[model samples]
Target: MSTTTLTPKITMAQAINTALRDAMTADDRVVVFGEDVGPLGGVFRVTDGLTASFGEDRCFDTPLAESGIVGMAIGMAMNGMRPVIEMQFDAFAFPAFEQIVSHVAKMANRTRGKVRLPMVIRVPYAGGVGGVEHHCDSSEAYYAHTPGLLVVTPATNADAYGLLRAAIDSPDPVIFLEPKKQYFSKEEVDVTAPVPPIGRAVVRREGRDATLITYGPSVPVALAAAEQAAAEGRDVGVVDVRSIVPFDDETVCAAVRATGRAVVVAEAPGFASVASEIAARVTERCFHHLEAPVRRVTGFDIPFPAPKLERHQLPGVDRILDAVDDLQWEES
Candidate 1:
C-alpha cells in the first residue's frame, strides 16, 4: 500500500505529520512518544495532533531524559511493539548516545536475529535557522559511523513523508535525521505515490558537465549552485543522496562517471564525514572517467558557531559553486 493519499500542498513538517498519522493507522503496534511530543506537538510541531487523533496510548510524551526515552523504546521494540521516538534537537540527542550504541543498536545482533529492534529515532538536524548552541548540530556522521544504525535524511517533502513511514515499518532501528532548515519549505506532492525505499539516491537535475552530490539541507544549496553553474555555461547535475549509511553507490557512481567530475556537499565538518566517504567512493568508482579529483564542500572542522557566524561556517550555494569552479574540467 502507498504511504500517501491525495493531499493539498504542505510543508515538510506537515508532510511528516501525515506520515506519522498514516503509520499509526496502518499498524496498531506503532507508538510515538518523546519530550513535548504529546500535547506540545514536538519542538517543530511535527507530531502535532497525533495525541488528539491517536489518543494517549498510541501517542504520548516522555520525560526530558533522552537516554531513558531511547532505552524504553528499545524495551518496547524487544517486546514486539514498534516505537518511534524523537530527540528534540540535534545536539540534545547526545544524552541518549550510550543507550543508542550499547543497547538499541545491538539488540538484534545480541538476539541473534531472532528479535528485531524495530524503532525509529527522529532527530531534527543541521543549521540555517540561526538556532542557539546545541540546537543545530550536524551529527549525522557519528550515527553513520555506528554499525547497526541505518542513517537517512530526506531533502524533499515527498521523501520526508514517505521515508518516515518506511523507517517506522523497517524491522531494524533507523536514525531519521530531518533537515530542520527545510521544515517550513513547501512543495506540491502526490500523496498517493510510494516513494523509493531507504538507500536510494535521486538525481534532481541532469547534466553532463559535472555532478553535485549532496543530501539534507545541502541539497538545495547544491541544486541552486547547479543552476548558477548552468547560467555560466556549465551543465551541472545534482544528486540527492537520501540515505547516508546504505548509500546508493550505483547511482552516485553512474552520475559521476557520466559527468567526469564531482563535488560533494554536506553541512557536517570536513573530517571523517559523509562527504569524505562519498568523495572517496566516487574517486574509487570513477577514477578512469574523472576529469579532476572529486571535491568536497562542507562545514569547517570546528564547533558549530553562533547565529551571526553561521553563514560563514555553513556551506552555502556560493561555496558549492566555488568547489565546482575548482574542479579542473579541462583535464582529459
Candidate 2:
C-alpha cells in the first residue's frame, strides 16, 4: 500500500502570505510592517491575517512615509533583526531610494563585512491589472543596476512562496519585486518544498529554433507566444530569469546558444534596461553561436500609461511572436 501526498492549490498572494507566516513562526526576529498592512491587511491583502497571527508588535502598520518605513527596517536589520518591509507600490518606493542605495545596500560592504543586513524590501510591481499611474511600474532595473543588493522576482505561485522565504533567510539585503498582475494566479504548491535559491534562472519551456527569455509577469506572455509558435511549426523555448542581480549567465547563454536565435522580453523599456543587459551578455558570450542578432520585446520608453493605454505599452503575445518572426528565419 502506498500513500499519496497532496499539495495545496494556492494563488500567488496566498503563497506570499504563507511564506511570511512560516518565516515569522520559525524566526522571532522576522517582522512584517508596511502601509495598511496591519488592520487593513494591505491593499492586496498579501499581509492579511499576519497581524492577527503574530500580533501588533510583530506585524503592524506604518505611516504612508515610504522613506521612514525603509529607514526603520534598515535600523532594525543593523541591530540583528530580519525585517520584511513592503513599499506599498512600485513607484511609491522611489521616496525610499536614498535609504536603499546609501544605507541598506552599502552597509555590509562599508563595514568591511563586520555587519550583515538581513532584510527584504518588497515592492509590488509591473502593469496588467488596470492600475493607475503610481501603482504599476517595472522598477527592477534600478535595483538590478545597483551593486551589493540581491534583486529577485517570482513568475509563479510556488516561486512567490519559495523566493520570499529565501530572501528572508539571506544575510544580505534583497529587493523582492512581486509581480502584482500575477498575485491572483493560482498553482498547486507545497509550501514546504524547496525551490532554486536566489541568483538562478529556470527554463520554463524547451525548444530548438528560438528562445524567449523573460521574467516576472512576462513569463506567462512568453510561454503563450511559445505555444502559438509551436502551432505555427516553430519550436521556441522560454527562459524565466528569476534573479536579476546575480543573473544566471550559464543557463541563459546555454538556451540562446542552443537555438542560435533569441529575443529578450520584459515589461521595462528596452533602452539601458535589464533586457538590454541580457541581450548584450548573450552577444558577448554566444556571439559565434548566433544565427541572427538578438531581438527585444519590451515596454515603451515612457511612464506606465493609464489602464486604457497600458496594453499599447506592454509586451504582448502578438508582439513576442512578431519579434520571433524577425529572427531571420530561412524561407521554406
Candidate 3:
C-alpha cells in the first residue's frame, strides 16, 4: 500500500511515536519501560511525554542496567504483561545478551510450545550519528543467529509503524532495530493504514543489469546510487530486506536471477557481515544466473572510527557504482 498524501509536517520519528501512543491506548496490557523513557523522554525523545500521557503505571522508566531492563520484561511477559523494552543505543544491547539468549529465546520451545513471551525489544542502531564506539552498530547478525526471536528493521517510516505494530501485536518476541540516523529523517506514513505481514522483504526498485541489495539506513543510499547508475544508462535493482532474520530469499533470489549480478551494501563492518551471508546464499541459490563474482561495498574492516574518518570507511553511492563498474559480466 502507498503512503497517504497528508500534511508533510510529520517525521519518521513522529510516526513511531504515533504508533506507540496508539498501541498503549489500544491495549491496557502494553507497558513501556526503559532508561529515561519517562521524565527525560528518552535520549532522542522517541518516548517523549509518554509517561504523562499514558500515566506512570503503563509508561515508566527503568534502571541503567540492560540485563535488569530485559530480565524484568521477560518475567512480566510470562506473567501475561506485554512489555515493550527499549535499549538506549544499538551497542548497549550486548549486556542484555544473557537474558535474551538463555531465557527469552528459549522459553516457548522450552515449554513445549505451550508458553510464549510477547515482548518487543526496541533498539536504535547503526552509525552516521557521530556516536562513540559502542553506540552505533548494525548488530543484526548477533540476534539473527539466536533462534525463536523475530528480528526486524525498518527502512521507511510507514514500515516502522506497520512492523512495530505487528511486532507488539504478535504472540512471539521481536527484536526491532531502528536506524538511529533515520530517526529524524522525514518520510510519508499513514498511521490509519494496516500493516503488511512481518518477516517479508520488499523489492524497492527494479533493475535488469544488477541488484543492489540492502536494508535499514543504507536503503536510501542504494536508491541514490541506482539513480546515478540510471543516469549512466545502467539498470540497478534495489531490494529492501525489511525482515532481516527471516530473510526473504525468494525475492532476493528472483532479483539476482533476473539481474545476473549483485552487490550487497550495509553499514556494518565488511568482515563476516550480513553482506557476506547474502552473497554466499545468492551464489548458492542462483549459481546458474551468475555472470560475475558477487560483490559487497560495506564499512571498512576496521572499527567504526571518528566522524571525519567514518566517511571514507562507510560505503557511499560512488563505491556501490564502482562495484557495478568493476564487474565484468560475460552473458549480460
**Which model scores highest in lDDT?**
2
Rank all candidate structures by their TM-score, best first, as comma-separated numbers.
2, 1, 3
Relative to the unseen true structure, what is the C-alpha lDDT of residue 207 in candidate 2, on a scale of 0 to 100?
90
lDDT of model 2 at position 150: 97
Looking at model 2, report the run of 10 residues with the lowest lDDT sum.
1-10
On the 0 to 100 scale, the lDDT of residue 286 in model 3 is 96
TM-score per prediction, in order, is: 0.97, 0.97, 0.96
lDDT of 3 by residue, 90-193 (tens): 88888999999998899999999887999999999888888866777778877887998888899999888889898899899999999888889886777767
- Distance from true location, Cα of 257 in model 2, Å: 1.0
Candidate 3 has what TM-score?
0.96
Off by over 4 Å in 3: 1-7
Q: Compute the lDDT for candidate 1.
A: 0.91
